[model samples]
Target: MEAKLDLPFDADKMLAGLQRWVECESPTHDAEAVNRMMAMAGRHLALMGATVETIPGRMGFGDCVRARFPHESREKGILVLAHLDTVHPVGTLAQGLPFKRVGDKAYGPGIQDMKGGTYLAVEAIGQLIKAGIPTSKPVTVLLTSDEEVGSPSTRDLIQAEAARHSVVLVPEPARPDGGVVTGRYAIARFNLRTTGRPSHAGARLGEGRSAIREMCKQIIAIEEMTTEACTFSVGLIHGGQWVNCVATHCDAEALSMAKRQEDLDAAVERMLSLKPTGNEVHLQVTRGVTRPVWEPDDKVLALHAQAEALAKRLGFALPHESSGGGSDGNFTGAMGIPTLDGLGIQGALAHTLQEHVQISSMVPRAKLFAGLLQNV
Candidate 1:
């Protein structure tokens, strides 16, 4: 086997860039905060000779940044997908989610989940350019701001760009065991509302149509829909106001995931087919974010084979897996384009306070990614 490729930057510089990203705190819902993070990343990309274009945000999200490294070739190239927004709020760092290193591990709210991945891609391109490696193909890097919230504003852009590229690479954080993802489950989010008549609990309790009571029954039914291939959960729910009066309204947010698109479609249809169980109570089910399952095809499998060979050349096993969490790769891979995902730094505990990444894995993972970029 050949020796491992050397990373362009050292660990200290890598950690410094990661610290800046984690400190920015670009939560999906906070447009201004996400925009600030975008600006920071755009400046870095600009210095690497990539032309940046800002895509204005819609539906109350931050603007997206697309950086392109143009080449002379007219053939299709690689599309690098990176999300700038994370699940952490603006004050998460100040609220005890400190960006610190402990014995070769870095802990922060968004560092492990994606900021680490984004910076890894950025540094990879910088290294490629600085090393005077001639571009084999055109490279486009898309940094969207709404991935944490399901990429509502940037899904179309992702699809359109993927259609033009030969391969799409998503730099979502690698698996806990240092594996890259080859497929993802389809995710469907629903907003459910139960509306009914309210009455005085003390005076006319029997006459009241309790929406909360009705929703509780529905929630149980939904929970029962979980199977080995499909899972459902009610993440958020709110109903009653005062103890004296009967509840008139109950709102809930439920999510479902399935490994197959057909199964997910059937499950969602059944959920929407729910009828009111309580007298005078009406149920409303509106679909929220829907991400299609990314199933591996022959092209995808071939890409994975190449990735595995490349990883072996660097003296490691590149295990590919099917993930329960969905990412933008689902969009492109499901669209029939050859796509490879989880090509980012190895980490775990994403989207949690305890989220962290192995500090020692940064350089090796970046070197692997850079090698793939040159070959794929």
Candidate 2:
């Protein structure tokens, strides 16, 4: 006979909890705002009877919340990873993307990208506690404050904590096809700056070397370096202070992603080898935080297979694939731990104004998460 799992929380309660989180607006750069979000999550975990700790932030990032659920044994258990930070800035809610439900979609900042998944995962545990259901092992939930910015401050902490766990589950928003992530591509960030001589635009146009012009040329070159093995794009750029004067300095940020580590290494080398187009201007390239390629091994595949079975029992097909965007799973999976990712809410248009989660998917996904907690 097939077994049954009953969840104590319903869709209405889950949506209400998720709306509170989406309204908080914890952008990654704003440490105080992220801390507020962390505080909220910590309180929820505490109420669920989990031993919670708020680790102090470092390197200008916000604090991290770690909560270990009560269990009989102290043996190695499961790690549920999530991030509270988002790419959207403050006032985004008031200006646009206010939390609202329309048809089967609920739209808001960070709702689909992750806040929904994080809330549901915690709710699953909370409901399990309410139902007096015990998991196979202890569970640890780590909610970090910086991830959209590459997780620079929390990478070490992630790896260290993951080392103490048997398996890692990352709820980073389900795939567009409602699949999970088994492997992740490698990612690298670059900081580029160009320096040039400045002069009065109206009086001495020919005498000045425009840093903005040089930076534009460099950006084109960098993007043109894309190949089937790796891809590059310039996302953020800043230049020119005065309209009447030639720009003296320009700075930009670029990102490259690769399916293989060697390809990323070559791409990094090429980015650093950039040269100034003109003798009057200087170009400099600096590498930033990187996410190592996570290729699934036997252990990861086995864990994914377990989720597949659980998903099947829950009356859903759980397909998985190697994804491009990196998550904290990239860190733990690359460490050879059994890791499964994209176990979050199903939605589309992440990191955009139209970001949303399928309202109907909330209860089903929460039940799936609850099943994994008990069976995996």
Candidate 3:
């Protein structure tokens, strides 16, 4: 670990940026709202002498922005990944009101989920500029538009971008009480549908095959395919038109987490092989969504330890928690790059009307992030 990661950084400017982001609304899969928020943040970044680029993401309404700060020293490279799209819908602007500061907290729709965290990246970068910290690697801020919806169009881009960097630092919101997510589960969602012949239960109960019955058997098999550390759940189940009619089609969603690639493949294969009621049932498995689980490589673990030491040096104890949730860090970690996550301010109630951030905590978190970027 380097001592520079514990240095002081500008706090006031960071808070202002966070405040500005809170005032803007960026919803998932809605490119316009995301673009609007990105533009606002880009203006300030431009004034800092950083070059900016924009790419239209796969989501019709989403935009991805990258702000590059050239490095003065010779080194590999660093990437900061954040999401521009939030979980809120388009109408959240009028629904929850503009961001308002309440004592030490900032309240709004997107504040805690991501917009506030996204601003932290720029805030920290700004502080690094003010401090005259000279990093060896060029810094790139990669903000994508489709994260909240599983990065359908941006996952490949994220992985490709990760290939160009030696390290990745993510500023997703910190865990409540200021801890970061250390290990993340890699996740993939599957939509499984079963097709069967339908029959009227009361009039001709034996005339048709029951898809619902087969689906129930498959779900039971799927549930049995789990261990403790990793498991599978049949989350969504739908079948039948009415109680009187045997269902001709059944649909369900399955979620699974893996510790490694082998676990993932085995799990998927097992789920897809389920046999219903000892009868052959036509099954279709389509991906619903996918997310990277935090399985940081040796580099990531080392960087996390370094951050812990840095926090102690800066007079705070920033412990980390193992997470079952997924994030962009998952993609980077899987690429074998050292990565750190949850560098944003500590808050709770993300993705809800209650989403809010500890307004006063922004200063210290930004300073810490700036310090980490300078040395990492």
Candidate 4:
């Protein structure tokens, strides 16, 4: 017979707690804002009697919060990985995506892209504590602050923590079909800069080589490198100090994603080998942070199987797939650890103005999370 799970999850209370988080607006680039969210999470964990520790952020990022629940054994256990940062800016809640509910959807900044999931996970643990239930293994929650921007500051920390834990569970938003994530595509970020001679546009246009023009050409070349296995896009660009002056410098950021590590390696080599079309302009390419592809191993599949069984007992079918996006799970899964991801609330339109979470998913997801916490 299967083990019984008693998870008394209150959707209204969960939404109320999630509202506090969504209203905080912890964007990735804003260290202060992200830290505020971390502090709030730390307090929540403390209230639940978990030992909470705040790790200071480096490289101008926000802090990370680690909460370890009381357990009998010191053996490796579950590592619940979550991120406190969102892509939305601070004023997004007040202007573009204000907190509100319409029909079955709750709209807010970062609600789907993960505040909703994170809160639900916390609620699951709190419920377990309230019910005086003990998990099969110890539980530790690591709330990271820089996952939105490739986890530049917290990558090392995530890897180190995962090394100590038996498995990793990422509450990144659930798939639209309520499936989980078993794999993630490889991702790479690149910074490009172009330099050219500046001159007065009207007086000496012929003497100037426009850096912006050269960058535009390079952007086209970079994007044209996309193939069936790998894809590239230039997302950020800055150039031209003044209209009257020929642009002397241009800088742009590009991102590439691939389904396999070998494909990403080839793409990265090509990106680094780019050269300016003409000798009149100078071009530089710098590789930024990268997320290695996470392919599910047998252990990962086994963990997913356990989750699938639990979901079925709760009257839900849990399908899983190798997803395209990157999450902190990529770090642990690539480290040869069993990792499960996308176990958060089910929703759509992540990283958009229309981002929202289905209100009905709160209870079921929380129960699933609680079941995992107790049995896995």
Candidate 5:
């Protein structure tokens, strides 16, 4: 086998395709917007002669899109995982984050945090088709609708489809140093609520059992759960209607992240074991999203090694990093399948208004992806 294969990737063409995807904003919770985005992506895949399947949206999310490049065999193959929905809400493009190029960087809401990566997958596949490169296995493309929100609606579908593949490639986004992600932290969220009796603070303060006070104690305890391996934080909180009245209810959302499952389980056990400190105040905790850790097992490490070698053939060191953030790759990795992430275009400032993709890296990265699709 040759060290380097000449795979054509047009930077101008990829940029235009990525811009079109960026302009079609698909927030996780907006079914209509994400459906529209899925429709556009389907058209592109259809044009590539792929058999596209549009799975209706479930659990109140946008539709999930799947495209298959069938080979001679109907056996296991490569699964290209991507998410169509973004963290940005509707009207974000008009809020000073419109798709624009300032120098070599292209700014947009979903460009960096994965619309660019998704389009890179499309272009890479297109190049493979145009070059008439033959593969031993088919290539499957899955663009889910709810990855930004922990893939609540698409988790089962992702896992089910990934089970049928030999390898999974997730084009999430390269790290700041253009490194691919080898492992990702496990994430869990919770909704906490406190109940107490309401009373006038000025006249009946002694009789009021303040829910705010109860929640403050819980917050402190939750903060104490943080460590180098495990982190906990109260991201959202709500309580109290009037300042002169003792708070009767308080609600908060908490998040926890850990590098290993044992650590996450320990933290969750502690959170569920929390008891109210104040008398007559009640506490309730509900578990929300829980994504298992994607530890870099031997299979995943081997995949990374192959990716690194491939990048070297292209004249660059493809370093790998373990990320604190999670992606749909976590699902496949946790399922014991060989999964590699950060296969997307290089970019920075994901999930922020300053999110952008480096224009110059598009072709080379797309070439890298094409090489993987053919070589893997």
Candidate 6:
């Protein structure tokens, strides 16, 4: 085996790499886009001297890429959680490229939301190779397809791998002040459906119980169940075949956030308990906790401490923080593993057209990650 040690990553090289990633538009739920990005990333990883494996495609164009700096044994491991899927649409890049670089800020669709974080992971590992430090633990960079939409299929894979590792690091972009996120709030998405008999407008209006009305009542009930401490939104609503006739059915999907499982269950219970009048209404709730809250557990804190020390070594401050945004780290943390987030290079206005990364953050953040991998 040949060991190469010229891992010094130049920011320019990283920039070019990022441009390639950014140029390969990947939307949150678009499977084909994700496949393209994975293919590109896989090739890059192979060139970096990693033994790469392309996880079978999930559903549509969705796929995951796993790469490891090959070692003799699977003794112990550290998993790096990253997502190649962005919030941008499939034609977003070509529609306008959105790629603008000024001074040190580079703006693009997935720049800050994630592609930047993914870039950091690659750059960091490259540094380790350059630094000539055999990885502390065999490292696996698990980049998935639909992180923005939640890892419905990949969650299991992430957790299973996380359970086997000593530490899990998530590059979920940085905080506003460029601090890495230490804690993550849990996310629960739900749907409510109501059914009522439709009747003629003026002829049998009273005979037909309005499902739409029942749905409204349920929506109000769900809304009242929320508080400042808890974030909830009944974002989608649909019903009514015709305005003249009574609505035979209604449905709404909502997003909820919680600090604990109890909080999540309580919210679900409330929605389920909602009883609609006018028509004997049926309320069905489909709830899923994509990423449960990772409230800084002791082991998690220790990991953060190591991360902070590593940042200090690189002349940067690792601001201790947590975020409401959900990531696969939450999945790892929920499984009782020490998970650390926000190791990515840049952060700001994520998931938007204004999304961008601080070009200056590239090298230092990579070094910070390398420090954690080598010394921690």
Question: Against the true structure, whose lDDT is highest?
Answer: 4
lDDT of each: 0.87, 0.91, 0.76, 0.93, 0.89, 0.78
Model 6 TM: 0.88
Summed backbone clashes in each candidate are: 0, 0, 7, 0, 0, 5
The true-versus-predicted C-alpha distance at residue 152 of model 2, in Å, is: 0.6
Which scores greater on TM-score, model 3 or model 6? Answer: 6
Model 5's C-alpha root-mean-square deviation from the true structure amounts to 2.1
lDDT of 2 by residue, 1-376 (tens): 2224556567887899999999999999999999999999999999999999999999999999999998998989999999999999999999888999999999999998799999989988888888888887899999998999899999999999999999888888998877899999999999999999999999999999999999999999889989999999999999999998999999999999999999999999999898999888999999999999999998888888888887877778889999998899899999999998999999999999999999887887788888888766
The residue-by-residue lDDT of candidate 6 on 1-376, one tens digit each, is: 2223235868888888888888888886778878998999999888889899998866564889999887665777888889888877877766654787888889887988788878878878876765667776788888888777778878888887787788888888877787877678778887778888889987888878777888788777677777866667787899989988988888888888877767766766665566655436666777754567788888888888877876665677778787887888888877787888888866577766667888998888877777777644
Can you tell me which runs of candidate 4 are displaced by over 4 Å? 1-3
* lDDT of the structure predicted as candidate 1: 0.87
Task: Please report, as a residue range, the 10-residue window in candidate 3 with the lowest summed lDDT.
Answer: 1-10
lDDT of 6 at 243: 82
lDDT of 6: 0.78
In candidate 6, position 9 carries an lDDT of: 67
lDDT of 4 by residue, 92-144 (tens): 98788999999999999999988898998899888888888877789999999
Worst 10 residues of 2 by lDDT: 1-10
In model 5, the Cα lDDT at residue 120 comes to 92
- Tens digits of lDDT, candidate 1, 1-376: 2323675668789899889888988899989999999999999898888899998999998999989996888899999998988888877898878998999889997897799988998888788788876545789999998887778788998999889999988889888778888899999999999997899999999989998998999999999999997899997899989988899999999999999988899889988898888558999999998999998888889999988887877778888988988899999988999888898888778888888988888887888778777877
Regions more than 4 Å wrong, model 2: 1-4
> TM-score of each candidate?
0.95, 0.98, 0.82, 0.98, 0.93, 0.88
3 versus 5: better TM-score goes to: 5
Candidate 6: give the clashing pairs. Answer: 7-130, 31-61, 31-62, 32-61, 186-293
